[model samples]
Target chain A: MEFLLQLYADQTRWSTLPPDQAHAEMGAYAAYTQALHDAGVFVAGERLAPPSSAASVRVSADGKASVVDGPYPETKEQLGGYYVIDVADHDAAVSWAARCPGASHGTVEVRPIMAVPTAA
Target chain B: MNSRPAAYAVAERAARESYGKLLAYLAARSGNIDAAQDALADAFTSALERWPLDGVPRTPDAWLLVSARHRLFDRHRRDVRAERLHGALAAAARDAQRDFERAGEIGDERLAFMFACTAAAIAPEMRAPLMLQLVLGLDAARIASAFLIAPAAMSQRLVRAKRKIAAAGTPLPRVSPDDLSARIDAVLAAVYAAFSAGWSDPAGVDPRVSGLAVEALWLGRLVADIVPDDPETLGLLALMLHADARRAARRDSTGAYVPLAEQNTRLWNAAQIDEAESLLRRAARARRPGRFQLEAAIQSAYAEYRFGREPAWNAIVALYDGLLRIAGSPVVALNRAVAVGRLRGAPAGLLALDDVAVRSDLRDYQPYWAARADLLAATGARAEAYRAFERAAGLSVDPAVRGYLLGCARRLGTAQPSAPSSASEGKSPG
Candidate 1:
């Protein structure tokens, strides 16, 4: 099964880190990614820009579109990054989620990807 | 004797013993469970049609394997990809055939198949049904009957489960010991579920249904053999064997329910008791006591009674205490209370029930009410005891048990008004 882990964190906490500490954090993430690759489970992942620079788009039922600035600002937690990994079951996915760096201070939401059956 | 009837008998016996082995072996080798099942079904049909005329082959399993392999080859020949791999497929089939002919066993393929059938990818609720069908070759109707569900619904559930498994692709290689140990509980639960289904009715009117307990025990024994050091597996085998040994005494000559304590110890299967005792000893050697081991130990304590000897109620109480410490379920607590009632005075047992009484799940539980009535009657509280027994009789599904509880209530009512009832005089619940 393929599971998506969405990492969420407080924007201010991430922004306040020292430059060298931020560098070390990135190195840790790289090593983690390498470990997943070695385990042959890595699918795809990416770090997102800050919520301060984010925008939201909504399409009404009538098909009229509206754009908002700053991710609406009321949301305290921001989506920082995500990773997709192939695992055996929910337990395996949860075990991987526990090892996520985000788990220490923030949250990682693990969701199983529903398989859309392909006609054979 | 007609050869046709004798041939059918041999086929029936083969279905009971070798169906799982042949199906599991083919499924593992082919990596296509559905196809393997289809081929094996066809093989069985062919056996029924041809066995009488052919006078039963010396190596029935090998004959069935070869027939199923041919069907597999025919199915593969239709696929373009299989056409390219014909040489490899033929070579593999030959090897499997040779192995089957030389040795009746499938090495560890059945074990591998068991793990695959209960794989985590499949929904937890569906594992046992899938195991019954895929491993034991039980049809959907029988599996549905065992689960008390409509056959159509059971068939649909099976289809969905099988599709999900097939979608996941070929079963993964043998899992690590850590993974095996983690899923051991669920696997054991499935086997026990099958056993309970069989043992639920002591009359054994339907051999297909009643024989499930034997199959489950066989599966448990095979698992214990494969995982020799797993204490819980040994414990599970012991538990099933202990319960199975008392099958004969569970019902009276007239088919009335016989509670464990009132059963004739001579009716118990001596060999099964011996096997269960040995298994319990082996599991105890592991020193990591699990729920099943504790439960088996309790049964072992009861099995020690023989030749008009009193049961070691104190040992049973201690084992129940150990079990309560580990499991802590209301049901186990109720059982422990019965044991305590047998060992200590009725008042002490009544006091112990208070701790478990807080659990809302036991409000209408038959055993709880039955145990409570026994304790109440023991303490000379006839009025409360009568009410509890009435409630227990109302709740009991078994007619014999309901009759017994009603009899207890009537006997208590008719006793002299001033006399305190001897609650501890009757046999404890099984």
Candidate 2:
């Protein structure tokens, strides 16, 4: 089963960290990604730009479009990054999620990717 | 057997006896639990329909296996993913044919299937419920009630879990010896959780909650048989059996709660105690101690009372000390404090209880309050004991236990010859 692990952490905390500490944190994430690759379960992963760079978009019933300045439903913790990996089950996804550096100071939410049915 | 009722009884008996074995064999072969379950359900439906008209087969299990195999083939043939499923079904059919020739006995892959249920990929909380459904053939509603989950939510959880198992391709037979210990721990925890769920409903007023204890025992015994040398497995079996043996003595004839210290030893099942003792002895020979072994040893200490001897409280206290070192759970600490009270005195017990009172988890835990009340009463602190008893009674979910606690408080209040203070009469509101 494939699962999408959303890594959420407070964006403000990243800015307050000392330069060396931020570098070390990035190293930890690099090591985690390397481990996932070594396990042959890694499919795709990317660290996102801060929520400040994000825009919220909406389409109304009459097909009118509206754009907002920041991410939708502003919250303390932001979706800092995400990893989509093919693993055995939810438990396996959780195990990987725990290994992510974000889990130490933040949260790693695991959601199974819905399997798309093929046309018969 | 040609009669519909007779055929139904025969089919039901066969299902009860071999559902896990059949499902395990099918799922292990196909590597898809969801499909295997659907095929087996269809097979049972066919059995109910055909057995009366055609007469029950001499080897009902083999008949069912053949029926289920055909269903699997047909179901897959209609699927867009038939080519891939065909290979697995073909292999399963070959095994089914061999087993059919062997007559009544079907292959037992239940241990592997059970291990699959506890795979690292599955969520911890869902493991036991999934085992109950897939391995034991229990309906989701019954399992939901036992676990205190909403029926619809439980059904969705089970469906999603089954989908994951099918999609993830959990290697059933490849559970290597390197990870067996960890896997077995997961399996044992699930079984114990199931047993605890049933044991909590002491009165057995709900039919849904009552049968899980037996099913868990059956699962424990099955695991013990498959992993004969694993001491912890035997220890778990012993622990469960010791508790089960005392089930009859947990309540009095009047349906009042009977604490273990005052329970009638004669009411306990001697046969089950003997089995537990032998299993514990076998576990001890392994020379490796675990949480279950320590717990079983404590229960064994109490079982000595059945022999007309005072319980070996010293050994029990020592066992709890060992348990505290490993588990250190509030409940274990509370129990240990109670044991310390028995071996030492109320003051020592109170000191011990005070040590664990700092844990926030024990604030609403009824047994902690009850233990404190008992020790307070022992030290002649009647007023404090009365309040603690009231707190414990208010926290208790069982009506019998609440009534018992209230009775204790009432006794304490009446023991004083003077009219009770307004504070002591706090149990009643104006």
lDDT (Cα, 0-100) at B84 in candidate 1: 48
lDDT of 2 by residue, A1-120 (tens): 999999898988998999976755664565457556755788999999889999999999999999998888899999999999898876456556654667667988888899999799
Count of clashing pairs, candidate 1 = 1
* Distance from true location, Cα of A5 in model 1, Å: 49
DockQ of 1: 0.01
Candidate 2: stretches off by over 4 Å:
A1-120, B1-14, B42-60, B70-94, B99-104, B198-210, B416-430
Task: Supply the TM-score of chain A against the true chain A for every candidate structure.
Answer: 0.91, 0.96
TM-score of B chain for each model? 0.80, 0.83
Model 1 chain B, poorest ten-residue lDDT window? B198-207
Q: Each prediction's TM-score against the native? A: 0.65, 0.67
Off by over 4 Å in 1: A1-120, B1-13, B45-57, B70-95, B98-107, B121-123, B177-180, B198-211, B413-429
Q: Which has the greatest TM-score?
A: 2
Candidate 2 docking DockQ: 0.01
For residues B1-430, could you state the per-residue lDDT of candidate 1 as single tens digits?
6967877766655653466777665556555666667767888777767776676777677777778778768867788775444443454456677785577545446666677767778887678788888776778888765654446777898988877766666643477888777677777877776776522321112122245767678778767877888889988898888777877776688765566667788998889889988988988897989888988887777776655666788888888888878777766776777777778878888888876787645643556666788788878899988877765554443444545556677778898323222222112213
